[model samples]
Target: MAAYTVPKAFPTTVVGSYPKLPSAQEALRRQRKGEISEDEFKRLVREAIRGVIEDYIWAGVDILSDGEQSREDMVVYFAERLRGYAPGEWVRIFDNVYFRKPIIVGRVEWVSPMALDDWEYARSVSGGRPVKVILTGPYTMLEWSFDLHYGDRREAILDLARAIRREVDEYLARGAKYVQIDEPALSTRPWREEAELAGEALEVIFRGVSAKRIVHICFGRIERILPYILDYPVDQFDLEFKNSNFRLLPYLKEYGYDKELGYGVIDVHSLQVESVEEVKKAIDYLMKLDIIGPEKIYIDPDCGLKRLPRRIAREKLRNMVEAAKLARKEWAGEE
Candidate 1:
């Protein structure tokens, strides 16, 4: 168990996804339709991932991911690897986006490592940059799935928590310094009981894992559960801000948010690339608040950029990195 460290202030990163290339998407379609061999599809996917790594490097992003190129859907990808789960019908998450919801048919179990190979490949291509390993948290996994075996939701979530814990342990053993657990459903839980259970499950998931733990929540107001969630054992809270026009910062300041902040400075749902000036303005706004200093801040997009065009995604990241560098200078009184 070692502590995670960042090299400098306002480090630029992404919230773990890049847009899939059209050729990769077509290859996936062909593989699903049985039009191409599995080996061929995988070769195309590996090539696509290399291109994505290059995109991040070119954009000057300090932290990188595998771009999730091998994954069709976040929750379903892990469900397919774990035991006692089967893919169900497509369920709409939002506009034009859908995933085949997973159905839990029996006791959940971790059969083997799920994202290790992807993380290894990402590290190999990162050119010594720290690759952030992102995982869909247990609570989100259970919430998005149809649980038939564990009739009780709390029981099911805890079981999934243990399964995810195993995966996190494996990542830590393989030299992962930063591991993020995405639990967007934490913001949408309708009941206090569910929220409490989610917090407990998060504790279970990160138990005994020493990597820098981050939890990403997006697309919903977090003021209601921020108090409860802050108690979870994590090193940073990656949140959406640009989409809400920085409305949440004041609330976080008032509540005395003490953990490291993954400040989202770009909106991912839109194709319009934010100018460097716009991003700098957003960073300036946060700095003026004085709630968290530059050392505690991380700059990134509001969410994964998989929905946008590849060109737009790259441009957005490039601007974000530039803005962060400019802000870093201002923080040091160099500007």
Candidate 2:
């Protein structure tokens, strides 16, 4: 078990990305067009992150991220920084939405700390709150991109894992106590080899980090990888629960999974915000299931809130926080 202890149990957090402020969106547009100086762009991004952090605090989140204002896209952000990638053609991730795919063209290397500046600035302004740094894990980076070099997939994956390890080390060295490695791609291909490769990659990235080591995998065949990931070195598994109506609970119960469970109480993909009572009821149900106890539960949204409107995101988070409070009150006797 990890030495890290929660500030408060059932702590509220996010799945890493939150909506960018309108001003920050505009700044990204201008920066891409070279209409603003690099320093000016950095300033705007910091302010945007501050705004999101303020929102999180107001919503009563116990753990916070920078809202990832500095990233355009999760995979793209890391691809742009690492030495091996080049931008490829656009590819559709959803029905109509598309993003430029990254192609590996040379040796993959973590030249420097990609998120140090953003993390340092965010921590400085977080008002004593613990700030977490989120990174796109190696397996996802490999699965999401095109590899024109490093003909062997395992070689490329391990190289990317090394890069992530270095970045995680940087965050730890810089006082970050929480780091979440997002590997949403683990479920994309439900093959044993795929899961095994991801496991090996996670092992490399997760070694020697004493902080709250978290791995987040969502929106896929979670059951397929459950057996493999249950043994992963991370202290917690932050997964999508609400989105799947907690379908995997049975698997977790049957396996007697024993780790911190980042319960997804809010559905970020929905426009209608969850009511506090509704969220509390969901927790009530989870408790009755007796799969995992309240001590190991960490409340959060199903996924990133970047897709939802800012107002809805705030309301959803507020409700999630309220639900956690209400649950704590009901379970007060246990303490």
Report per-prediction Cα RMSD to one decimal: 2.7, 2.8
Evaluate all candidate structures by whole-model CA lDDT and list the values in order: 0.86, 0.86
Instruction: Give the per-residue lDDT digits (tens) of candidate 1, residues 1-335.
Output: 23324447998888987888765787778977989986787777778778899999899898888888878888988999999898788989897878899999999999999878778887888788888989998889988899889999888888898999889888888888889999888888746676789889889978777888899998787777777777778889999999988889888888898889999989998889999999999999998998888888999999999989899999999999998889989884533
- The residue-by-residue lDDT of candidate 2 on 1-335, one tens digit each, is 22323445577788889998876797789987999997898899999988998898889887888888878889998999999999877999888978788999999999998988887887777677777889999999988999999989999999999999998888888777888999999988878888889889988998888898899999988988898778888889999988888888888888888898888878888999999999998888878878776778888998889988999999999999898888876864422
By TM-score, how accurate is candidate 1? Answer: 0.94
Model 2 residue runs over 4 Å out of place are 1-7, 333-335
In candidate 2, list every pair of residues with a backbone clash: none
Clashes of each: 0, 0
C-alpha TM-score for every candidate: 0.94, 0.95
Report how far residue 9 has shifted in candidate 2, in Å. Answer: 2.0
Determine which window of 10 residues in candidate 1 has minimal summed lDDT.
Answer: 1-10
Candidate 1: clashing pairs of residues: none
